[model samples]
Target chain A: MKKSINKIVMIGAGNLGTNLATAIHKSGYQIVQVFSRTSESARKLAKKTNALYTSSLDEIYPYADLYILALPDDAVLGFLKSKKLNNFFMVHTSGSLPVSVFKPFSNKFGVFYPLQTFSKNKILNFTDIPVCIEGNDKRTESDLMKIAKNISRNVMVLSSEKRKQAHLAAVFACNFTNHMYTIADEILSRKNISFDLIRPLIQETSEKVKLMKPALAQTGPALRKDKQILSAHMKMLAKDENYKKIYSFVSKSILSKTK
Target chain B: MKKSINKIVMIGAGNLGTNLATAIHKSGYQIVQVFSRTSESARKLAKKTNALYTSSLDEIYPYADLYILALPDDAVLGFLKSKKLNNFFMVHTSGSLPVSVFKPFSNKFGVFYPLQTFSKNKILNFTDIPVCIEGNDKRTESDLMKIAKNISRNVMVLSSEKRKQAHLAAVFACNFTNHMYTIADEILSRKNISFDLIRPLIQETSEKVKLMKPALAQTGPALRKDKQILSAHMKMLAKDENYKKIYSFVSKSILSKTK
Candidate 1:
């Protein structure tokens, strides 16, 4: 039988690090050490997780069962290459990076990518966050899965390639979707209209997709192919060439989705 | 004080018509008649509101305090010109069309646009839906505002020009936003990943905007300006030229928002 993941050391006290470490700590696992480039972030997360704090990776507790590298994507590879691998398991919480990044350091490594956006100030409930996990070996996968299950109910043993695709999908759904709202906010603010006026509509649009496929939930001049209204809307954006291009291109794309 | 709106004639039994009529009827107003080009649609909505149903405009009950034209934007002007108007107030539920569309038909006309997407089968709560009301005259404005307030808690006496801009903003926030989800769904389905995996992320993105400006809430490769990941994502969409263009263009737009 594989040993259960008990003691953890969280590296990089950024947005994801703070939330993930706190979650693991709350799930009855002991977070042994919290590391960050800045002592303030390290101390802040360490206090929250009831763990020891360090500003340097050299000072990370060597005896922890798992070390979670929650640093930025670029920092992850260099950090993994430089660190000496012990018998303990290690994982990085990134969607785009593959599990093989850990191959140079150790075979007892995996990935624990929670597919959600994190902000330092925002409190998160990890109970339902979809944590995409992958391991280099069966034993590592099982251990990581157990630890992931303890924190999130929605844990999937996704492949590295699939994790990359999920990350891309999220860029469109979360990032591009938020950009659409930013454009709307910009348009309204131009006329001195409050963003609150569209908040209910925004809430309903997101809520509608939860109940049905977004393709089916779509409604607007674009979907209707109402040229008059579409041209009028385009004309309104004539002064802003970038917005007009977006309006035209996205509208055509949406039209193509019509059955 | 203006006369309180009580009796209503709902023309068009489409999505917006059904939802608006139901909400107004539920607010204790009498829906005198429901009109639609399709007899079945008229019958369906009429039965729901306990009102008379008619497929012909000539058979419409004309004595109601208000006539709500919830028809498509293009159909509104033609229908207004074809029908004879009495002294009773009339309003069309459109975002893009101006209140001046009524001046060619009747001086007693205005606009009562509820800024939310509607589906025929979906039940809606009008309490918080933003109902933008515009009137040709002071008396008409008061009557429409009273009628609007009864159905929705969020009512505004907006001008026609601002209403058009609000509608434009909604095209971005609601319609284009749904398209972004559609793109994400397409990408995930290509890899056989269930859209369910991203639902939590989609929900959190929307919820974040409610708390903060979408610009501030933005995350992902575009916001991070991670060149490696951005190019990686763009390469993934190489097969679909349309999607690839959107990925590149939208990423540039997102990068522009960084301040």
Candidate 2:
């Protein structure tokens, strides 16, 4: 097995795959091939990296030093079971899946999970995005770490269990947090208020967490336990049962955490 | 009433009050006095703004152009009721309360709500903070807008009802969003992972909404309707009922908003 990973095959041209391939390629690594279920996705990503594109698994470049499976968790296992191209060092970029998933498929494998939300077309600096790495062996681990270090300054070796926990935490912090913003947008739209008005508040709230513990940084009517304001907000949300439920549930949750 | 508000009295020395007083003072307004329930609180904020400190409502400067009741919503009314210093134009910084809350106390009154979370020690730039202004009359609105514009580049005249809705939206956007971070912290701590791992994701989530509608920026297993990953995350949260409830509730909320 090669200890130094130079040439790469990205097996999924999705959001993570596209961003990872582009970033890795930009860092002077050779992107040998790009593969996706759709030729359009493969072509689009391949064009950015100046690499070949393919929609079929059989068409993937087998000579690359590494194959990055940036597919969904299920697809990762499915792809491995479908093919026996285990000559290269393999890694699946999944938060929940373990490095052991590649045990039956490849003798040399690891997990290279970049822990960040990636949306296609959004320009991102991969320098600070946390890349969680785990390998079945020391050489495989070192190879994975080499690629990860080249792309990110924030990299850690996390076990599958720990990585999964971080993933669960991210779902709350990123996904659910965005949902809160969406609800706020919905609420503001009802009153014809522009979402721009609350952008600073949202920005400050996120910025505060970076500086202090989130619990210590929390501020609002709920944390204040202002019954008057809480009830007033609940009444305002009364028209929408879902929002009302959310407001009450989250408020209660906050109150419960109060010391 | 004066069309220009230069001399001001700040009532309350809490997070919002201290920050607002300092910002307003720094903007060249003369903060004549600072009041708080605790003398030490009043004195500390007073020292920053070069204003007199008072714990008693009776000691408040009666001749200032504006009496900013940066107190709690109830305290605003309480202070007004407890004193008849209605000669000056009055304004309260609150999201939920309407300008009419001051109708019984003074004719020259308005709402000067700076829509951002403020920490007492954290230095913040008020230049971009949205200042929602509402006044009882044209002259009062003009006066409040004058002061607001002095401190913030972003200022708007929003009606009481609309301001209340905006406040409601802010509770969701800021308060609830922070709670999500707290929950994420809890989840991460269980596996001994640093909170730093998810900061980039959280920061990006907030950054995305500034450029795009949050609903469009949403990415996760819930939004993607990946039942397998969703079930796995739910299982991970199974031990903590509150966290589990929050996880399932928010994931469902995200799914409901899905295209």
lDDT of every predicted structure (CA atoms): 0.89, 0.88
Q: After superposition, how far is residue B111 of candidate 1 from its true place, in Å?
A: 1.0
Off by over 4 Å in 1: A1-3, A84-88, B1-3, B86-88
Q: Residue by residue across A22-128, what tens digits does model 2's lDDT show?
A: 99999899998999999999999999999999998777787888889999988888898886576557899998898898888878898999989988888578999
lDDT score of model 2?
0.88
Model 2 B-chain TM: 0.95
Q: What docking class should model 1 receive?
A: high
Over the stretch B19-60, how does candidate 1's per-residue lDDT look in tens digits?
999999999999999999999999999999999999987788
**Which regions of candidate 2 fall more than 4 Å away from where they truly are?**
A1-3, A84-88, B1-4
TM-score of 2: 0.96
